[model samples]
Target: MRAIIIDDEPHCISSLKYDINLFCPEVEVIDACHNGHEGISSIKKNDPDLVFLDIEMPAMNGLQMLDQLGGNIPFQLVFTTAYDKFAAQAFRLSAVDYLLKPIDTHDLMDAVSRVKLRLNRDVSRQFDNLKYNFGRPFAEQRVAFPHRDGYDFVNVKDIAYCRADGAYTTVTMADGKSTLLSKSLGEVTEMLPVKLFERIHHSTLVNIQFITQFIKRDGGYVVMGDGVKLAVSRSKKDRILSLLGLERW
Candidate 1:
């Protein structure tokens, strides 16, 4: 498989090439780029089968460069980064692989092997998810939910509340539409910003911005902008109230 490496650190680029030659002999190093801009231009020129990308760059980061592609990622991406925090975002983008700095030979081979197996699968959905959330602050992040045919990208601000049912969670949007996600509530909870979303009940998480009223009736329930009443668990009632700027003395 043809591949290119995009990293600002010259030593890392050289090390990756060495590892590929020794361990991942199936992959050929086509071009080594120093920045995202060069990576973009080289990608357009080489049209390689895989790209070893770096997350943090001077002008355009890896995600930013992918965003500029408009739609449909042209090649498989294996992100090489120093930060472990970027792993979540990388997987959300359906990246073929992620390797931290001081790339491991065994891990490199394993990632490449996975890439070879999934070269034909459609990763556009993953890209859509990345385009919405990558590099953005929690307040600006969006969530991707798989629907019947494609995926739904909803801004965090547009989410009213999330209801958990068994392994699935129903996400109610501000527009009165709800979508069912196959993921468990606990899994989805991690994707949302804690400051913007608060878990009120064991099965309910609500967007604090969408909450319009806090009723002190029957233990307590919060009224959303759409007039939907969500019951708040006793444990979370005080915290939820405090989050809404209503402190109980």
Candidate 2:
């Protein structure tokens, strides 16, 4: 896979390139740039398969650089940034891959793998999501749920619950709408923010805000806002109850 590294810090660029060379040898470092302008020119010239982009830079930040690209992006982007709480959250909501600075070999290799896997897939929406949410608060941030056909963008708060459907998951919105995800329940859980969602059963994931009441009968279930009863597993009972701040007694 042809790749490019774009970061203002020379050391960061060097370390990332070295790790890519050592661990992920399949990805060729086609070019490296010190700022967004050079990065844009390199992208136009190389048309690389993957780009490792740093968020902050002088004059033109990464987002601004992307805006300058006019949304005609063909390369997969994996953002690399120093750990800022909000910036990390924006990446997650954007459903784009990212590596925290002082990069780990494992994460670097994994990011490379993702880029190669999704090289030809559409990423315009992912870029849009990041750009849109970067300036917003966590509550206002929306997530782009990726399924087989494409992505379904929605507010995390609107998701009522998710049920395991074989290898895929079915996300039921609070308004009785549903979207099928091409990921397993476990995988879908990873996509959601943990603070607002909880696994009450091996087959069920619920948005804490939409849970109306807990029923002890029928192997224990929770009533959702839409009157759906989702079972709670025996093993996860105490922990989920504790998380919900509900007393079993």
lDDT (C-alpha, whole model) for all candidates: 0.80, 0.87
Residues 1-249, candidate 1, lDDT per residue (tens digit)?
899999998999999999999998889999999998898889999988898998888888888888777765768878888876544543443333578777888889999998897675566666666656656766666666665555666777788899999999998999999888988889777777666788999999998999999999887899998999999988998898789888883
TM-score versus the correct structure, for each prediction: 0.71, 0.89
- Going through the candidates in the order shown, the clash numbers are 0, 0
> Model 2, range 40-99, lDDT digits (tens) per residue?
999999999889999989999888999999998898998988967655887887889999
For model 1, which pairs clash? none
- What are the runs in model 1 whose C-alpha is more than 4 Å off? 14-31, 37-46, 59-72, 81-118, 121-137
> What stretches of model 2 exceed 4 Å from their correct place?
84-86, 234-248
lDDT for model 1 comes to 0.80
lDDT score, residue 54, model 1?
A: 87
